[model samples]
Target: MDKDTKRDLHSLPKTLAELVGKHIVAAGLLVDEDPERAYKHAAYARRKASRLPTVREASGIAAYTVGKWQEALSDLRAARRMSGRDTFLAIMADCERGLGRPERALEITNDPAAKDLDADERIELRIVAAGARRDMGDVKAALAELQVPELKERRARPYVARLFYAYADVLEELGRKEDAREYFARASSVDREGVTDADERLAAIEGVELVDSDVEDGVVWTDVEEEADEAAAEAEATASRERRDDKGRDHRRDDRRDDRRGGREDRG
Candidate 1:
């Protein structure tokens, strides 16, 4: 429950406010772990508090997380109208792209407020707009769209790694392997939170096989190989547990059958 959400619920009756707040909190908590469940919770909250812009915003985000592109776009549009804020224009454009409407995505980017977005939101808009360009098979235009001054910055902001990663990915798509590799390394250097898989991209570019190791100096050391091995081990353990449970059930059945036979013999 953020301050904005609290303010939205301020006008509601106490009982309705509590219920909507619980649902919104549940949706927020589950959005990362189980997005489908998160969407359900957000939907419930929206149903209860349909007039609240914050509720619509939460539902829109939850819908996006679950890939319900049309629903997300609709909810986000409603949120924008109610709140008179265009903060989610990037997400709206992304939802249009998700629905396979690259032209519509481009159209959304033309909105006047799109230029007024904060730096991070502007970067996200550029990324999505670039993606839409790529979707339209104009890879050159896509490459051009991502060329911004922020890409040249050596200082690490949360969005910088992502920008570098996007640039690297596009370069790879254009068969500029050397340039792509350089940008990937740059992205990896600045990615303190492991937000992008820049390290994995770098490994692929250099043909470096990765293994499981402890994180050193903020670098994530895990690899797909280790993840595969863990998945296999878990599957084997599950099968073993099932086999033991089956065997135990069989043993109990045998004991019951023997006890019945002994009773019959005693009766005879």
Candidate 2:
């Protein structure tokens, strides 16, 4: 857990604090690999410490991860109220969209509190708002909504690639194939971490087909195949890290049990 979460739990009795902290830690650990189990952990923490805003936040995020839209929206709203922070507005708006309430999502973007968000948060809101417009079958309006100056930046920031990709996707939706291809290429170039599948989209636009090297008939090698291999390798690496983290937690639990048994022996 982070320092802020620890501080929030400080007011609880020691035993209760320890239990909630353990659940929260488990939730964080399992969230990526096993989101359903992570949601269970977060829910356990919420049950134990219902009054804690951080616990509510954790529960909300876990619910979101697991696609429990209603639960996520309720928990996130409670968290926002308790914490008096609008940091999760983007997720909240997304949850609204998840519930098929695009109009509600747009309403959230227009909220007075939205103005207080930082630059990154505002960009996130614009993205969601554009998505909401798309949900309403207004592709042109969606494209217009994403026409922020940040989208035209020459250098790539983490947000820029996603913004460009979103714009390109909207362009494609509106039958602007050439523009879509151009923007997809631009997005792919800036996407150093391969966060978006911009490369794949660009390849599809250019009618480039990729064939697996292990195919029996004919194997065609292309840059797209190399990119796919890299993506697979990265995914495997992430899974490996998650496994290591899970093992580390189990070892810690075993050590604690051993310590308790040793304490009993010492007392005897």
Question: Best candidate per TM-score, number?
Answer: 1
Assess each prediction's global lDDT (C-alpha) against the native.
0.92, 0.89
Relative to the unseen true structure, what is the C-alpha lDDT of residue 51 in candidate 1, on a scale of 0 to 100?
93
lDDT of 2 by residue, 206-267 (tens): 76665656677333536666678899999999999999999999999999999999999999
**C-alpha displacement of 215 in model 1, angstroms?**
5.7
Candidate 1 Cα misplacement greater than 4 A, ranges: 218-268
Tell me, by lDDT, which candidate is best. Answer: 1
Tens-digit lDDT track for model 1 on 1-268?
A: 8999999999899999999999999999999999999999999999899899999999999999999999999999999999999999989999999999999998897788978889889888889989999999999999898999899978777789999999999999999999999999999889887789998889898766556656665344445677788899999999999999999999999999999999999999
Weakest lDDT window of 10 consecutive positions for candidate 1: 213-222
Residue pair clashes in candidate 1: none
List the candidates' TM-scores in order.
0.80, 0.76
Compute the lDDT of residue 119 as modeled in candidate 2: 72
lDDT of model 1, residue 195: 87
